[model samples]
Target: MMRPVQEICFFVSCGVFLLHGCGRHPLEVDISDIEETVHVERFDRELFEMKMDTADHAIGYFYERYGDFFDIFNTHIIHIGPGSGKRYPSFLSMFINDPANREVYEYTGRVFSDMEEINRCLTNGFRHYLYHYPDSTLPRVVGYVSRFNQGLFTVGHFIGVGLDQYLGSDCHYYDLMGIPRYLSKNKIPEKIPVDVLYAWATQIYPYNDSVDNLLTRIIHQGMLHHFVDAMFPQLEDSLKMGFTGEQLTWCRKNEAQMWTHLVEKKLLFSTDPLVIRKLLEDAPYTYYFTGESPGRAAVWLGRQIVREFVRRNPDLPLGVLMSRRDYQEILRESRYDP
Candidate 1:
């Protein structure tokens, strides 16, 4: 947390503006050296399939390879089943050794056989992070097939990637698994870098304040999204916002209307948790708005407020903004009208 605030502020002021190259900040860290420093472990291919012919040998290999994480691995992957603990041995055994699951493994194999491009994206993303925060802690990236349990998560210093979650949107496995179409749409390779970076960002700068109001929750998520956006400048706003291109367009077109609706309803400063969830949480769509309205409208609005706040204070560094605890102060300073 300290590193994110200190180093990011330092980097912002030093004049290194990537993309447009307009900032006065100079990059302090060498991008080339980051590859050697941060490592991404391919546990999916290397461990899961390494000795699949024999579970005993596979178990032994895992125990030796990840002695430090054997307990967590056992709890999350082996002992507990996807999304929960295994209740039936037959079900668990099928998930591990069934011919169909093996087919699923082979399916993932084709998609992830060449992780060169993904590795490069992840490396670049981490490099950008290190560039801003030189002393930032690095996580040991572990790629595993979670049977579509969790998408990606960080356990201690290890970032666990569930490879099965990215088997393309149209992959038949998703249909067989009964995953909703909307949920599987983002399971493409390009989204992996964002997922990894966002997961790491949340670990480094988690929301510490209470979420008693709609505005508070939005600003909190807005801060995280802003950090990720700065790190991945090339990613589209829609992708970072977790919206479709059309949905983003709808938001922009109706930005004024959405703001006006919030104001007319006096919902921005309201401390109603239900109201907060309606606007901020993920749903099929925001029910208050038209069906065409994108889900998570509050997050989008919060992002706008944050953008305006930064725009109004060009001299302010991102780290300083993140470090500030006064959400109300930020909103007031932003003078966010729309």
Candidate 2:
């Protein structure tokens, strides 16, 4: 009887041990197993490389003449220095090296399908600048390749840094389109693939940190957009061309609503240098639709200033108009008053 009782106790203990596990803690399960994959396309590396090279050459030429401005820019605009060890490769190299980043580039290309046209406009504008403003300090050959390296690192960083995870898995197709009307019309999946490739294009490099900082600073300066716009009128046509007929129609139809949104969001002057720099630092998503911080700011600010100026001076010609030296001198004299 005693033996039987002892045997029963032993079996009970064995059963409990088997059910609970043999001195093992409960295993933790990862949530990733339940996560879904985001689907998106990649960018074309060769095309991107070509574009970057063009921009780089353009910027290099500018720097050679305006090295002083660059130095001042580094001091006043950019907070960081070359010693910070930031390393930015060419946009193409970054994209090819990181397979994960391709999606964003494809999305960017789709949204801005007329990028080549826009670039052409820039090239033409630069050439015009050289021809008309022969005495100006601006570069004569503002090639795409030259401009590519000027602030490429900073521009890339503003777009790419801290954005991989946000874009890689959370990006939606409609989000890629910069049009608010389109985004409102199409509802995308909650968790879409992030476009990392675009980030590669916008990646910030160590050597260009000063350039990035200075550009951001200059963008913040009041009236700078107006200066750029007065200098480059072809940009307006280029931007308009980026929109399709349907898109333009949609924009017109929703003009009131769009303006309302812009006013409410303080985006009407979103191109203001200060406003743009803030947006770049604070709202990366907004920057994407707007273009990189200073670039988008330049466009938006140019439009705003021209609209106001044209409204006041309706007699002004639609063609490229130059501000008289006296007017610039007066503005400079009164700069502190505003």
* Cα displacement (Å) at residue 321, model 2: 11
Error of 2 at 239 (Å): 4.0
* Candidate 1 per-residue lDDT over residues 5-68, each given as its tens digit: 1111111211222334455322223466655434457776665444434655655666667654
Off by over 4 Å in 2: 1-123, 130-134, 140-246, 262-305, 314-338
- What does candidate 2 score on TM? 0.28
lDDT (Cα atoms) of all candidates against the true structure: 0.68, 0.30
RMSD of 2: 24.5
Off by over 4 Å in 1: 1-39, 50-70, 77-95
Please name the candidate that would achieve the greatest lDDT relative to the true structure: 1
Q: Per-residue lDDT tens digits of candidate 2, residues 55-148?
A: 4564354346444433332333332232112442243245334443444444433433333432333343334334434443332111111111
